[model samples]
Target: MLTSSNANKKRTPNRLSQHLDVLLFSRTRLEGIKQRRAMWTDKQRGIRLSQHELLCKNSCGYYGNPAWQGFCSKCWRERVRPAEARRLDTRESGEVTTPTFSKFEEKKNMEKGRRINTMRRLFWGGPSPPKQPSDSQMNALKAFQKLEPGDFTGFLKTLRSPSCQRLQSRCTAFLNTMEAYHALQVQKQSDLVQDFYQSFAEYFTSFSEAELTRTMEHVEKLIMTRLHKWVFCHDSCDDEQKDLTLQRRIRSLNWVTPQMLSVPFPEMQSTITGDPFLPAITAIIEMDAKRAPQDKLVCVSKCSQHVFEALSTSNSEPANADDFLSALVYVVLKANPPRLHSNMQYVIRFGLPQSLMAGESGYYFTNLSCAVAFIEKLDGRSLNLSPEEFEGYMRRGRAPAAASGVQAAACETRHLLDELMSRQERLDHGVDALNVQLQTWVQAVHAQIDQATSQLALVQEEVTDISLSASSSTSSDSAEIEHLILTDEHVGSPDTDC
Candidate 1:
């Protein structure tokens, strides 16, 4: 029993010793694993910190871990940006800085070398630099790089110079010339309008009394045809041939005085003996006998007596013999007597200007030439009066029997003046309307200029505001750089160094 117990004790001690050996081996394996993990972690952290320090030093001339670095990434980026920008600027400008051999004298040597090289390249093309420039070369290159007058810089300078007052004067002169030209054009237009009126007058005035009678007959026929069409509703007419016959008849009709048509019998002799009306009537008869004795006489004694009585009773003066003779001529020449009265009244009311009356007489034939001369100066084809022919006509004097011709001329003159006045009134109305339109156009131009000026002012204000804002931002950035420098100086020292 003792041997069995001793064997059990020995087995137990060996099992316990095996258990302790397993525990100790397991603990040692765990410690070795922890040591390897710590070594790997330390190596990785060291590598990261070293990489960060290298990057910072190269980029910003400073070195440290990223988190505890003296300078921030933003600050480092800002500092490097200016250096890169300066390098790029130098490269673009074709200017390179040479390295200095000695740090103590670096700046002085670099500056001297730069100046010498620049001067050498400027004055000499050969390998050896020239000692001095020739007179011509010096003069030529002295101002070569400078902006001259009429160049971009010079132009900008002149724009701001007081000498620019000359531009305002030039603009004023141009405006004056434009206004003068406009006035001359207006005068030319006025002359044209007047010439048109005068030519219209001469066209009618040149017609003989026989021609006047024919024209009136033609117009009357046209009026009659139109009236027939309106009353009878016929679109076609055979009146053209009949109108020509009527016109021929009207032209053939002779002008005669009232006295030739109103020879009184013995019953009317008592009123006519030594009477005032007798003298006027006798004058008309004698004038008619001298001028146109072959003309037919129509005795309307009762009408003649009534006309004389009406003239005597009315306060208005008796018609002059010349006027009476013209009236007698008009009545005899008309184809349709009833329409003649109204037409005659229209002719007398507005067509009795003395200048036109004088132009019709052989004595005042020079005035007709003047009218023709004026018309020839116009540009239109409607009426072309040759100035040479008009002057020739004026140089020649009047015919022998001027007085008798004057009476007939005055009647024709009245008709021409009436037609011209009507045309002139129409032209005046057209000119007034055109003036109104021109005024409107001028107003519109002024308004457009005003609007453009206002918009330009607004745009200039916006540009000015933007430029000021940019300048303020630049100043703020400069202030930030100074602040960063101050912060670096304070933070880089020891805790008690501030």
Candidate 2:
């Protein structure tokens, strides 16, 4: 029993040591795995940070974002703060400095910065300052704020301007009339609008025709700019439904081509040959970006001008009105601009009657409306294509196999096809010319061979006639010559003399 106890005690220490070693090994492995996992996580985090890091464009040594125009948040705050805030800050410093000549220069600098920053905030994205009214209605209310008592010059200027308090009052009155009509569920808003314009003209009776026309235009802009949000593409109206239908129609017709529309677009060899239609297309696209009727009309005019410029540059003769309209149609198709129908209706309904009914601006706007109308009713017959072909193209959609290319190239497959067609035409022409020349040469050789055969036949006939005549006279002539020679020899013989 004592020996057994000694052996058991010895085995107990060995077993404990083995258990401790296994536990230590397992812990060490777990720690190593955790360390490796932590290293990998940190590496991934560093890669993500490096990939997405954007330094402030103002060199402020901080991160930036597009919402702040590539500026850090701190820089954006400084940029958007009004200059008056800076003045207030200086005044609140509570210590009056000694007056110096440089004080005048400092004040001038402050005013300059104030004007610049105000202009910047007005044009760029930022909160509006007190002096600049961001809203059209607000502008009208504040127009008189800059005036002093008995400032006749300022009053007259304000009265003459579109932002005049008088015009705003008239607009507000008209707006109330519209709201009353809306509340009464009246459908004669058009008549009310026309009556309002007539009253507007009465208010400016002393102005010249041109000045009145211009003022009316500005008034239309102010009224429409305010009315646009309330009325444009409203759910209560059919404009939204029309917009959806037109968008879907345009999407389905994405495979349309210039040829399909008979647009007579210039056949360009390379896309890099200056995209003449780019400006026109861009203008057409920007039509959706504007809110007011006048602004949209201006976009239409710009598109028209760009289209005309492209047409004039491409053709030897000046582009006619028909060509301009056709090119405009093609531009609309290519751009497939969104909300085209709604925009056209908006301009037609709310645009100034004087502007829409007269001048080149009116003419261009009319043509654009016509182009949209044509597009709305377009079909295979309109494009002069068979229904089957049109449907086939529609089925193939915009990314047709015949027109596929890398997006970066910016060249359409149709342009490449057009170039290939031209090259093939030149090749065919050369082949035709070569075939004509070969036929002519072959004919000339054949004629020369016929002449040579006739000459050979004539020479053979002459030789046959000479041979027949010689055969007929040969025997008699030979016999007579032999007799004559014998007689002469007998007379001259020496034996006969002896």
Best by lDDT: 2
Q: Which stretches of candidate 2 lie over 4 Å from their true place?
A: 1-157, 160-167, 176-187, 270-274, 397-498
Q: What is the lDDT of residue 196 in candidate 2?
A: 60
Cα deviation of 465 in candidate 1 (Å)? 2.2
What does candidate 2 score on TM? 0.47
lDDT of 2: 0.65
lDDT of 2 at 184: 32
Candidate 2 C-alpha lDDT tens digits along 1-498: 999999999999999999999999999999999999976554333111121234446776554444345554456545754454456556765597644647745865786677556333332223342243336535543554445543445545766676555454556766755655453311134334544666556555555676566666666666666666666664556777888887887777666655555454555443345457889999989988888777888888999999988887777688766667668877887788888877876675566665665566766765666566667777666665568776777787425422532332356555667889999999999999999999999999999999999999999999999998898789779988999999989888987888
Local lDDT at 145 for model 1? 26
lDDT of each: 0.38, 0.65
Candidate 2, residue 241: the lDDT equals: 84
